[model samples]
Target: MSGVLEKIGQTQDKWFVFLDKLESRMHEICTAAVPEIREVFEQDRDPYKRAHGHLLMGLRGQINQMRSKANEVREEKIFQFIDGITSELPGHGFFTGSHDRLYTFRIACINRHNLFEEKIAFYMSLLNNAAGEQDLEAAYQEQLQAFEAIRDQFSCKQCAGQMTIPDLFFIATYVTCPFCQTQNTFIPSTGAQMVLHQARSLAEQRTAHLLKTYEESKPKNSLLYRQYLRSMFDEWNKIVPDMAEENEKFYQRLLQDHLNSINHY
Candidate 1:
């Protein structure tokens, strides 16, 4: 009994020491990666988020490596010790004290692991939210104004007739010339192409107050969240009506995910 207790204490101490070192490593990784993430968010010109996507994938791989190390340590240091002790003293009379101490040690380890997971999640949230630092609404408006200014400057290729773009088109579209009765392919400017990429963010900004209202609710009002989501999608569809079908699917998925979170909570 005394031998088992001493071994358990030694294992717990080693486990805690490893966890402390791992936590410090996690902090260092997140601290070093945050500025890089923010820089990518601010400077990366690709609307497809290719650079940020690669960064996140690498970060996630590193975090997962740390998680794997933690689990391996737990299995080797804690589980092995417990299993060895249980087998060595199968019919011993030290079950009460040994079992109590083992249970406490296991709980402590679990709590530490959970805390590490939560910390990782927090760091990820901070990294992902860095993209919101840019003024998406202003970008959207600037692109919209630019598009409006040059919309009437296009000429038909077939007969050289004047053409007026009747709508905000992010991609190349066939524009029928009024005078020549010919189809002209209209391509938007490089700046105008960004509106489609940032439309959702702009809509979210426009409806941020409603989201705040929902978040501020005592129990987190689902109805308020639905109202906010509906308004946000409405604004998004308003900005890019051509994408309404795809946006509706995305909106439904978001709403379902929110509901799942609430239920799980």
Candidate 2:
């Protein structure tokens, strides 16, 4: 599992770096095309050519919007991935064997990942429509698929072969092998217990490394950092379900007190 987290952390870091480069390239393409688009308008006095500039302008606008959304989605997804991998350690004995800071982090991470996945799907739809070249479109689609696959792979903690409680009950818990019933107490330790512990340790180490890298690599713009923090809080705010019923009771009590005060007066 730790190996999985480390892999996910590395992949997520790469994804963000790739997005940054891709966005820069996309911006350059748009900038380069702008003058050619303008020249098309200037050279051809035809009404069709004049209208072509408007079409180009619209395409440029759409592409820019998609690019912006893609970056936002990428950042959110990266944060979520980091959150998920680090969070698991505390719950599964990462910390003091009790769910604590690590468990909270894990839940936060899962929520963020889920939210980013939804947002990315929307961005991808926009990309599909805005992309001009067939090659570019194909490349973008491949990246999107890769991102989804990676996300899916990171969501689970254990391998398919890992024994579940039910499986354990049937195999090791209940009936001993007839030939080896006397040897039942000679149960050898499954490597899974050791591997799981090792995986958590590896995940924690990788997460700390990634966090340090991200902090060091981040732009020094305070305003941008503030904006990023705000966005993270907004994303976090969306995670919990509403306690409408609880709020309604409070409102009812307040209303009742106000009415009683009026009646006594």
Candidate 3:
């Protein structure tokens, strides 16, 4: 058993070395792209063309090339590494009788795969943004201020009556004018629209402890998960009080879906 474990450890170390070299190469190429992207941002005065159009074409092209190179490395090198450890070595199998060793080997492979996948995602996100960094909170606050400024400044389509929106809503909803009593459908900004979903994620964060408790349990408890889901929905409803009626229906649907997925979970 000790001999088998030693061999497996050596194989895992070799795989890690291959990953390190690949990652180093990937970083080198991506770093070379940074200056060109910065130059594009500085030179392009048309904001739309800078962000989503022609100015980004070169960077995107380079990113695709790097992605292709990484994929090729993953296929040729990663599989070869696995094959070296498991199949190509000898006729005498190391894990034929040892289930524990087999499990560990599979787990190690999965961890390495997951690490590469995350690294790829990070590179993609870094490449996509013009500034290479985003101030999400600042953007959200700016959007909120814009919404607040225009919230009360809408005219009734039916009577041309000035009406103040009573509440901030992300999605389209009927707003009744006080003077004309005409229900005008108010459409919110795209940023305001996403806030409707962001509130739910915030609620999940508030109930993260309950979720952790359920997830960390051995021989997983369905009741604990249900409790966590209920608590999360409660928090969600509290955050969006006006959406409580709609949220309740969603909560029921989510619960039923989760129940149906218990076996899979």
Candidate 4:
């Protein structure tokens, strides 16, 4: 009986030591990840943050690998030991007090593991919030006002006839001169072009509340996500109605992706 107790004590000590090492490793990874995530997000060359997403995905993969390792260790080393001890408890006459102690230890380990998982989740949420905090609506409005200020300043290149740009064009477009019947390429300034690039972001900003509700729901209701997507695309089309067909295709593709992610069959 004393020998069994000694072995159990040793196993418990090893479990705690393993958890301590894991905690230290988790801390190191999380501490290193925060600055890298922020730097990637802030310094991304792509206005749409595509480069940031790609780099951050790699970092998320590393974090997932660390989590997988911890889960594997808990299952293989901790749970297996507890299960083995539990199976032997019924056969041992001297395991009454020891059994209670082992059960208490198991509960403590489970709670500790859960706490670690919560910390990881909280860190991930902080990073996500930071990424989504950009005020894209303000940028869109700034670009729109800049375009409006310069809309009437264009003149035909072929005939030097004063021409009014009737609509907002993101790229160079052929404008017909009424005086000479000549074609002139109207080129937008850099700021005007940025409006097209940020159109979707502005729409997202407009419909972010719906997305927030979807995100806050437990089990992540896909129906709520679909509603948010529809609303967001509606806002997108309102911004750039010419791209509605293309946006609809993109929306369908995203729905298919969501289906693939959640449905096994």
Top lDDT model:
1
Taking the tens digit of each residue's C-alpha lDDT, what string does model 4 give over 1-265? 5665776777767766776776677677667767776777777867768877876677567667767887998898778988887786766566587687787778878887787788667656654554656677776778778878887787888888888887778788888888897988888887678777878888988998999999999989999999999999999998777688999999999989988988964
Candidate 3 overall lDDT versus native: 0.70
Candidate 3: worst-modelled 10 consecutive residues by lDDT:
130-139
Would you estimate the TM-scores of all the predictions? 0.82, 0.28, 0.49, 0.67
Against the hidden true structure, what lDDT does model 1 obtain?
0.83
Model 1 per-residue lDDT tens digits across residues 1-265:
7887887788777777887887788788888888888788777887666898889788878877988998888788777877777676656665577788878878887787788778778866766665556777777888878888998888889988878899888888888999978887888877777788788888988999999999999988999999999999999999899999999999999999989988997
Clashes of each: 0, 3, 0, 0
Q: Runs in model 2 with CA error above 4 Å?
A: 1-5, 44-53, 65-76, 91-265
* Model 1 poorest ten-residue lDDT run: 124-133
- Which one wins on TM-score? 1
The lDDT per prediction is 0.83, 0.44, 0.70, 0.78
Lowest-sum lDDT 10-residue window in model 4: 123-132
Clashing pairs for predicted structure model 2, backbone only: 2-199, 87-106, 89-94
Ranked by TM-score from best down, the candidates are: 1, 4, 3, 2
Model 4 regions lying over 4 Å from their true place: 24-40, 43-45, 83-102, 171-173, 185-194, 210-234, 241-265
Model 4 residue-pair collision total: 0
